[model samples]
Target: MVSRELIARHCICCGGGNLEKSPAVLMPFVALRVFGHEPVEITEDWGLRDLRQGMAYTLCNSLQCQNCGALFLDYRFTDEQMEALYRNYRDELYNEQRIRFEPGYANVPPHYHQRANYLCEVEAWLAPYLPEAPAVLDFGGDSGINSLFREHNQLLHIHDISGVELVPGAERADLERIRQCHYDLVTCSQVLEHVPYPLDFVKQMLPALGTGSLIYVEVPHEALLRAHPGSLQLATCKRHWHEHVNFFTESSMRVLLESLGLVVVDVLHLPVDIGWTQGEVMGLLARQA
Candidate 1:
């Protein structure tokens, strides 16, 4: 295996020039897997490609703006390719095997509890500033399960790329539609990192907010990377290009949001899994100043 350190040194996001064999960081490569050997389609931006697994091939980790500290492995996908991966790809990394639902009772597993805990933390932090059971928009709310917990007082609006029928208020609206409306609170949990452009994504939502409206966002904290070295491998396995492209630290996240004129009200750390690492998991609540 090639050295990750060497890859980092030549990382395009870190490196000064076009992709070259200068350092591993500036230009790194990792073992990648694709399901069913699907069609490798090219994206309009030409930054990504859908690599059909005709044969496993090594490719550059792609260049990112080191100044902004964005490291994306320049891989694009056609809509069909994306659908195939999300629907059919079943592996330890992409395990759809463990169903989180069963029947009448809430299939509330440990993960659900984790989600509940995170939501509770947010509730506490925003309690003094927010109104009782305010309307909330959960960007990328996969199933709207979290909305169930807040059903009593909070009115929930869910937006996601794929329309999930599982949740109650599941909206098939795209991000564009989401940007047009204002809500009392917005919950963007663990979704921003997967976006191709984090800055642009947040900016789109700014016009929709009132002065005191709150935006609650979460991403896999960069500290988690340091806490669990093995996560590097796990990340690659569990849909690297599609799932997450931009990683963030608390400082980075603050800078990104504040630049858009949102005042950072509160920031907290959260773990990906409580059992695995003692890393900092980050949550940020911002409001228009």
Candidate 2:
């Protein structure tokens, strides 16, 4: 059974109509043999790799959300299925065997490092007005990287669901315990879109902050919608379907945050120069009052 939150409803982007729901199913793929000359056990669960398999690849027929215009993988995972899938993720595909990244390429930036920079940028911008040594918390502080707070020379206590595997000596945290603590600022970057219930996530995190505290959320700006329909380079990702279900535009983001009684303090457009993925529009949000 699909989790209620993952149930397909309205399109998040254009809000055209109801999304056509489908069942989640798996197919088999040989990643290396099909894409390159190596052996990577690709599975239908991986989505895009199997859909756009190769030169003679056949695209997977999944439902596109009418509102958000996102072609998403069906998210009907039963609790047992989701548990089994993620329970061994690190020990399995990501860690057991070091998958060779394609050669002649720069080491792609780690997701945590990129996220840390975003926190720093927000703090740098908000520091002038905030009191010195203000308390801050990152909702998904992967490795305490954001807590280092380099730009303002301040430290932020973090609360996360898990500890950092890559960074040694990082503190382990539970979301519930962190909520009991007070903070002046809260930052949750690039995490809102992956969640099935963004509104509730924000609602829960908001109370962890004190009065006049700020909350910063960053997510993709529906850049795919802005592309000319006929442009050949318009971005498309099959693998991404499983990960990012909610796509937000500037307007939609404002609507969602503001509806939760958080004032839209500011929106920052992320630099487009770093383009390993689609959509250049990333937003930085601050909650007011």
Candidate 3:
């Protein structure tokens, strides 16, 4: 396999050069299970030729920004690698490979097909802020199956890199089309954690925001980071990097949006029980400043 370079230099949230780095290990199974690359291939490609005895994973680093307290994996996957990682995303074949490495993964895919219970709470919370029958776009939202207001929206559009078939009433749109169209609400749910450059990813969506447009960004309120709020020592504890690379603090989320000239409407911590797992989500609501 070709070499995959680590591209993260500065903090993705605040763009800070001053970062704290700590040794971390990325399990070899992630290569085969998630990206379809073999363990030995990526280990060699990543230049960890000297795999110590009993070590079957790639040695990497976890970085935390001193400026904004954002924690993420040091590796920033390239576009090609990102494509490979999420190509089949949560589909049957993807689940099979993952289940080969982690048996527990088998229980997760069925939940993906169901309409997320969190969307009900999210829609209700957003109701007072949104207009009646708003035109909505779900960025990186696969199939628009769990998109808020899917049933009530005047127009519902889904922009996803994954080529999954959309559910009824949802139209597939390209990024350029999304930029040209004026959407009242743009929802990017459970996407930031997987992205290598969260800041740049959100910046790309700026053109889609009209004056009254509201952008909703949601990420897992990672337990480890939440347990030790504002602590730089998080890097030492985060030994393994998986699909969810960036773990955002509430302050870091604010900095990310505010830096983009967005007026922060509200930041919420919602408890979610998605059948498979119960966790908290850090949901941020923002509009054009």
Give the poorly placed runs of model 1, Cα more than 4 Å off.
Answer: 1-56, 62-68, 76-84, 87-117, 147-149, 169-182, 223-242, 272-280
- Model 3 TM-score (2 dp): 0.90
Worst 10 residues of 3 by lDDT: 1-10
Better of 1 and 2 by lDDT: 1
Scored by CA lDDT, what does every candidate get?
0.53, 0.51, 0.83
What tens digits encode model 2's per-residue C-alpha lDDT throughout 1-289? 1224344444433333455544332222222222223334556566874364433322232445543345444443344544443343344353322334333223443442454334455556667646787666767665665453433434455565444452443344466766676666777766676565566567768667667777777776555545443222222332333335455656656666766677887777764434355445465556565
What lDDT is obtained when candidate 3 is compared to the true structure?
0.83
TM-score of 1: 0.60
Clashes of 2: 8
Best TM-score among the predictions, by candidate number: 3
Candidate 2 lDDT score relative to the true structure: 0.51
| Model 2 bad stretches (over 4 Å) | 1-6, 11-92, 95-120, 146-155, 165-173, 222-242, 272-281
Q: What value does the lDDT take at residue 217 in candidate 3? A: 96
Candidate 1 lDDT, tens digit per residue, 23-98? Answer: 1111111122223332234545555466432423234343343343434445433345446545533333434232
What TM-score should be assigned to candidate 2?
0.62
Q: Is candidate 1 or candidate 2 better by TM-score?
A: 2
* TM-scores for candidates 1 onward, in order: 0.60, 0.62, 0.90
